[model samples]
Target: MNKPLLELKNISIKYDDKLVVKDISITIQEGEILGIVGESGSGKSTLIKSIIGLLGEGGHIVDGKIIYEGKDITNLNKKELMVIRGQSIGMIFQDCQSSFCPIRTIGNQLYDSMKAHMKVTKKEALERGEEILRELNIKDPKKFLNSYPFELSGGMNQRAGIMMAMASNPKIILADEPTSALDVTVQAKVINELMNLRKKFGTTIIIVSHNMGVISLMSDNALVMKDGECVEYNLTKKIFNSPSRQYTKELINAMPKLKKEII
Candidate 1:
């Protein structure tokens, strides 16, 4: 088998001296989608953030190594880490609005992102931006390139954010509940788009979500978290049909549907 693209070995995180994520380890190979599923406040988000070096103030990585492309990135300096953050590892947070610039045009944002990592002229950046927007199935890229964040709908903004992330052709993408804020119909579309991203680019993805349906649809493997620890990790099919942990079973049962059956 090919080597893993990203690996977290016995990773742990702590906030203000309190342990949050404990000894969690996972490996993601090229083009594979790994789902980290659990309820809110389950520390799955913390795990993802730690990998991307996005943990908030007062939080620290307490243990383990984050290896990417055969290098230990756990202790990389700020300058070295910046090279990897967006160019090698892209991230999509829960709220797209939070990531956008309120005062900047969408095109400027994408252009700036490209310029930051490479020596590209404005015209080249704009062309790359349009290409990504088209890949996301957005119509009228020229109009969108000129529009501000406030001018677009939530779904449009989400796709724009995705375009920004994909602009770099990063090796790994961390999607933290990328569609939780959208309506059910829109959510399905966004999820499908995320899967399509991998299909097109062969980018490894780690999606942290609470929706079992989303996980089952997008993930090759799923890991279930509770409190501060990972209680279950298995192939997505096995995790759905025959979870090893009772907590995971309960979580699967907790999803309400119109076609209900006895638990």
Candidate 2:
């Protein structure tokens, strides 16, 4: 068996004096996609944030450890953590706008992020950036790169954010609600691209979503959370076919089932 790529051991998180995420643990294997699903405010977002040290103001991990690539990162200083954040571990925010600078050109944003971690010149950065955007099928990289984030559509911004996260070629990506803001067709494109990213980079992904269908489609294993506690964690098929918790069952039942057409 292969060693786990990332591990959370009995972790708990709190915002100020209020404990939100209860004691929980998770392990992600190399090149595997792990889906975390639950209703809003179920601690899905906060859990992923904690992994990358982005729990925000007044929030902190109250218990356990976050081990990545065989190192305990729970208490690393900001400087050390920064090295790991985007280079070793990338994060996709639930709100794509929050991930980018509104006033800057999207090209500058990607270039700056890449240079922050890589020793690449401006020309090299631009080339690499164009390659990634084109790989994701973003049309007119030259024009789009020169435009500010506000000039692009929601789906484009979302995919651009993904480009920034992938800029560093990180080993693991923690994505929170990556598809929540797009239309059905755009959502499918984003979903397919995320899966393709793993195949293209061998990146280990942990995606947080409220959509059970998305989870079943994207992940090999699924973890269900409710009110900050673990509901069930198992293979995606098992979780879909025979979930161990009522919450998981309700989530599955809520999805719009596809009906077969009569001949």
Candidate 3:
């Protein structure tokens, strides 16, 4: 069996006094895409946030372990955790705008990211950023780099966010609704781009989204969550084609599909 790239053992999270995520365990192997589907307030985002140690003052891990590359990272210090994040495990939020700084130019942000992790000159960083942006299918990478976050379209921002997450060549990428803001055509392009990333870099991915269609199309394994608990988890084909749980069935049925044609 392949060793897991990342594993959560009975992980639970609490915000203030509320238990946002129940005891949940999941393992993601190298080069696999794991899709987490849930309704609003189902604790999907909370689970992702906890994995990267983003829980603020009122939020914390109540129990369990987080293992990455055979190391138990749950108890790592702030400085160590910072090194692990982005450098080893990258993340993309639901809102692309939030991932970037409002005051900094896109080029500067990417430059800082590259400079922080690797000993590279500013010119090298800019070249690296442009290379990634082109890989993500952004047109006119030079122009996009010069523009601020607010100047680009939502789709462009989404692609840029994905590029930023991949700049470090991390082991895992956790994406939360990566294409939620784009139009249908653009969303498809973005999804296809992400699906190709695994093949290009052998990067493990954990995508959290409400879109069942996208999940069914892209994931190898799927997990359904509700009310802060995992209701169902299985192979993606099995989960979509023959859901064992009622909630999973409802989610599958709710997915948009082309109308059946009468022969």
lDDT of each: 0.86, 0.85, 0.84
For candidate 3, the 10 contiguous residues with the lowest summed lDDT are 254-263
Model 2 gets an lDDT of 0.85
Question: What does candidate 3's lDDT look like per residue over 1-263, in tens digits?
Answer: 89998999998888998998898899889999999999999999888878888877998899999999999998788878778885898888778887799888898898888777777787877787788787787778888888899998888888878878888788899999897777777778888888888888898899998888888878999889998899988899998778899998887777655101100
Candidate 2 TM-score, C-alpha based = 0.94
Which of the numbered candidates is closest to the native, going by highest TM-score? Answer: 1
Query: Against the true structure, what is each candidate's TM-score?
Result: 0.95, 0.94, 0.94
Clashes of each: 0, 0, 0
The residue-level lDDT of candidate 3 at 118 comes to 70
In the range 19-115, model 1's lDDT, one tens digit per residue, is: 9999999988889999999988889888998886788798899999999988899987777777887689988878887788999999998888888
For residue 141, give model 2's deviation from the true position in Å: 2.2
Give the CA lDDT, 0 to 100, for residue 155 in model 3. Answer: 86
